[model samples]
Target: MAPASLLDLVAALPPSDGWGPSVATETTLDGVPYAPYSKADKLGRMADWTEGKDRERGGRQQYGNRNYRDQQVYGANQQNNPFGIIAAEEEATFSVVDNTRTTTRGRGFGRGGGTVFRGRGQRGAQNQRGGARGTFQRVGAGRGGQQQGYDNRGGRGGRGGRRFGYRDDKPQRNRDASIQVRPDWALLEEIEFTRLTKLSLDTPDGEDIDSYGFLYYYDRSYDKQPGAKTSEKRLNVLERAAYNVTTSSDPIIQDLADKDEGTIFATDTILSMLMCSPRSVYSWDLVLTKQGDRIFIDRREGSSLDMVTVNENAADAPLETSEGNKDTINSPSGLMMEATHINHLFPIQVVQESESAKRDMPNEHPFYNPAEETDPAASKAYRYRRFDLSLADSEEALHLIVRTELDAVVKNTISGEDQFLTIKALNEFDNKAQGSGGALDWRTKLASQRGAVVATEMKNNSFKLARWTTQAILAKADMMKLGFVSRVNPRSPNDHTILGVLGYKPREFAAQMNLNLANGWGIVRTIVDMVLKMDDGKFVLIKDPNKNMLRLYSVPNDTFEDEGSVMEKVEEDGDDE
Candidate 1:
């Protein structure tokens, strides 16, 4: 074999199968078909940097960079090559460790784990991260690397790392309901605020069916510049024969119901609460009774529904002691009682109860009686109005009868005629308290920065203001007087002083607060339709304490009866006092 010549060895190789691949009997190698190649074809650059720029300049191909195209030999196999060199097994086991010192800007445990740089203004915000322009995040540890708690590399590879939801650093709120939900009650429907806000209905201005009671002239002195020393008046407790008769119990409403005047009946207070339910943060409930086709909105005796809530819609609403509210006076229930007392006392004090100056309504006081009542009647007039809530597409008419109220009357300066007024009071608790909701010092700011003070109140007590406006609009009052009343002592709620009064057109105030009356009417109609579909039984519409939702429950008729009419008992006790 060693003596054989080089030509003999080459000739012994069984005649070369041509220069390249064999041309006969084979079109493919294994399963891959052989591709035609030309000898003149030139291999592109190994590291082409100019191809991308050239293509970008519109001089070459459009789809991708030509420089990065495949450059490997078509049929080359390095393992089987005759000139391939094999390294020692010991040398193959040797590894190179990167010991170079690299400084990581920032390290976080989330998807965007690298250093988070922010502008000067965003430095103090803990949750405000920069955009994902140059963020480098590592999601998990590399193979043989120690596992880390967080990695920035796990980001989805986009400018500004992606975040799923909003970052809310505030503590979660868990509030209690005004009325306890009985286990026996059945939940019928749960509606979200997002859906309720989308509803819209346009109803008439309403027709005055009947008017009762009388109204005294509103004292113009209280309307002086708010927070003025001269305008400050002590809030007087008025023992007036005030009545909050529910729809089914009210004789006027029952008569109207018997006559089929409306399919729904509610007082202005109850109706406003239902209309403004979506804006509420605190829990509240109203009882509804469906008898045949008619539904009545009622409030239980001593119900929280009759009370006004303070800072009910604030971001940091007043919490109960159990919910971590340290200040007892600023607690929701405490604030409600204080607000109710102020509202009750502020209205009567602002009116001049002179028989000579008083204006009489079409009918006498509906619930007040001189023979049966010991206390004098309050200067309030009840107007039973009917609004047509029937949809244009509906076959049947849907009417709502609301029993509205008027507190006082004012002489129109221009027309020299009497204008009806709806009186409400906004009280200030401790502004420095946790749940103050960034309220300004009403005593110091009400006169000079009245708009700022009112704006703060609107933000904090959106639900309360909206309800008052709704009531005023429902009553068709020419003016809605919001009296600023402050406690005589910030620590004590027993006595209060009226700072001043501001008058606003109901519609104008509604616009300022973004209160949509049509939307409110629509919500009412929707709830009414829902209740009408159910059996003729007592139902309750309750606002969820923590979430923006409302739940309708079918309850037994005797649910609240065990309470034994505490409102009347309390009123009787007050009368005795």
Candidate 2:
């Protein structure tokens, strides 16, 4: 006979509807029959049976009858005619015969030499035995072994074997990591302002006027270099040169002074004058006054003026009067001029053009215009006029000089609360050109003093750090090799990689390892989707993220060789690897 197929047997067996042949007795091609209860079909049948039993026990039922008496009679009769009555009767018949069977001689058998008795009792017994044997054999034999095993082992044995030991199918540990780097510097400055005033005079002997001055404050340390010395030296040299030239009585200076004294002197003197000078002052005085009346006084020099006071009725007097008018009409001799307000002032320093002087030297000439049939004197005069006009225009170019004094108490790192240098300037202007004049015009002299103020505010620190980390990662050779990965879909540009480096020292290794347990290089990228690392005993690129289009990963101790080998191995493994 052909070997039996397990699948074919299962298909041919009864379905899980309590009908057809049992799923047991299926056999492999070698003729080993499978246990029916252990088959998938029997499990399904058991499941259905369990569900049905649960439903019957839990569900509500209705009895259909003509009246209350009929329903009562139907329920009463159900006890005698319970469900499964036919199955129970069949089981009882098989059980009776099975119980009475002789252990060694209960089948169709041939007559032995020891005994051969034929009679009505024997014949009837034999026929009865044959009928019993046929009925019990097939069903009882199939269940015997399985029922015994279930009873002994508690129904757990004979099922598929349980799995044990290690598995290689677990997911591989991740290896990507990430970090951040911030901007190099902060780049802005602040400005401070004050009021200013100026005075001029004319006289018979000369223009001698007593000038009053006021001052303002400014700070310049923001733009000044930290350790600059060239500017200081230049300033000292200029001051000394000005003093020597002005004080000298040399013949050359005298001759030049004689030719066009006013013009030359005006240029030199004005140029030599300090950029900042005080121009105004403030004062106040008080006098006795009657109720509902006005009073006036004036004090003038070189005049025999007597003290006088004017008193007017409050209702008839004008609301206010001028100081000059009040002084001339009332107490002219004992004039009390009260100074109420004063303005701050600053100096304007002129920055001369050194390049112009260098260009004016004879040998430095790059171009020449030869005289062709023109009068030499006329040509020379014309050239001279042109040069003068150019120089005049150039001199008019706006040059602003600012001077300020700084005073402040600062805390020194070594000696706390010590006096530190403060740099201040008069009027600070943006170093750009404007119309005829520069943006700010300051006074010559001011008494105001200012201290340097440094203001700093952080702007987008995380973003700047991310940008720097990205640049650093991209500069790395390993990172550059993955340039193709940086190309992302235009629709989702932000979905990109970022790389960074971190560091750890011997002392920090344990903590770093613990941190790695929750967030290591590879898994970090899985969470934040970026690469990063620790290196040289420090957390280098801790702030980098995917938006930067770069990422970092740690290599073995021999970084250079190991990194190259790792990349080779990854490429060999698969495309994504």
Candidate 3:
């Protein structure tokens, strides 16, 4: 048999299935059944040296060996093969220590649903690269409270996103009230700006009751190419008589009240402030007096309401001396005074001021007295206007009379008609200084980026600009002139230079600002309704110093009497000096 060839022995063997025992009929072979197997199972080496090589390179799907990728345990299916050995029950408690380092990401509540684990792993690869333009990305803090990048351009590229951290370093703004509140002021009602914004009352265009004073023709030379070296002019201080008479102090308003011309009487200065109260940031107070059926809106002498504020609506407005502001000239009060002085002189300087070029109104100057006054009269015209504010549900007519003013007059080139103009000046302090509200360099950008410059002013000085526009519309001025005035030197506050002047239609400018006259009228109507229902007495409406709220108080009749008299005495003393 040993001599038989290997081929002869293979021929003598049975077929492939027949070579195995006929024991297929029996479930088990020698008391052990065959184990079920898969062809895709890895059957490589018993131990591998390159088991954790992938994990060292930051691979995510970690396996014991690359060749045995699908192998979990070495032939551990022991219910079948007789050669298989079962581990003792104590082996189940055996454990191995792994010293691998891992990063655990923290989650937070955001627009995303769950814990977003962004890291140096494969998931964070996209974020490490800068994202698309203008898209915001928020980065989470890493180990040891270290902040990561947060912005649309990512931390590595263009300007980083607005950081919400370090907010405690921001300067606190705690402004004081314009007028001190006394203990005797009894609380009446409190209203919020949100409610005022929702109010709506459609009122008709005002009718001119009477006209007074005179206006000079605009110089037109000031309209020369803005921002040009030739156009720049030194702003000179001019001594002129100007008045801001309150409603109760104006004899004309008193006469109208006597004749039952209107139930509400106010000057455009005070009326516009009330109408645009929602846009104001600084605190102010207006005195409202009810005599019989008439309501008079008046301001106390030397009130801040008469001053034009600078950047009052800015995100980081000018600070006061009390708010840790080191610069005295950039302080809120200081800026306001500078702005008020500029407005007073800027309008007068832009006009010809010649008798031949002057235009007289329908009547003579009501408050001017050449014989008793030494200073020249300012170029001004007063127009008394009336508007109907009565609602359909009201029983009687509700009318309001306001005294509006015009600064100068311009002749239309095509129509050859006299066009009324209202002049306002926007002053620039040090742009590099604190509390500039990110304003542009007016001296350089006024002509090239005029729109952007004006837009910035509109944003920073919303309250001031809104009041001016309201007054212009109230006067029905044909055009509004805005002058750009900058300090002669950034460090100096006394002297200023005119950069340029721009003109716009009153209604068009208001439209550009999205100011609604109907809404303003609605606020007036609401306040009037509240006052008309109350008893005949003096009331005070105060804007909260640090809040968007207006509070009404029932004050004594003589609340500001002593201060008024003292102010008068000071004026008289100054006049004598």
Please tell me which predicted candidate would have the highest TM-score against the true structure. Answer: 3
| lDDT, residue 453, model 2 | 12
**Model 1 pairs whose backbones collide:** 106-115, 113-152, 132-160, 137-152, 137-153, 138-151, 138-152, 138-153, 139-154
Each candidate: RMSD to true structure?
Answer: 13.2, 42.2, 14.6
Candidates in descending TM-score order: 3, 1, 2
Q: Which regions of candidate 3 fall more than 4 Å away from where they truly are? A: 1-123, 127-163, 166-172, 564-577
Which lDDT tens digits does candidate 3 get at residues 286-394? Answer: 9999988889999987788888898988888888788788999999899988999999999999998888878898898888889999998999999999999999888
Model 3: pairs clashing at backbone N, Cα or C within 3 Å: none
TM-score of 2: 0.12
Ordering by lDDT: 3, 1, 2
Q: Write the per-residue lDDT of candidate 2 for residues 1-577, one digit (tens) a residue.
A: 9987667777776567576655655455565443222121111121222223323333211222122222232223332433222456654344211234433222122222122222111111222222211211111223223211111111211224222222334333221221112242111111111211121111111121111111112122222322123212111111200111121222332343344221111111111111111100111111111111111111112111111111111111111123223323122112111000000000111122232221121221111223432321100000000001012224632111111111122233475533222211211111121110221111111111111110000011111122222222211101100000110222221222111111112113223212111111122112111111112211111111112121222222232225467878889899765
| lDDT winner | 3
Off by over 4 Å in 2: 1-243, 247-253, 261-577
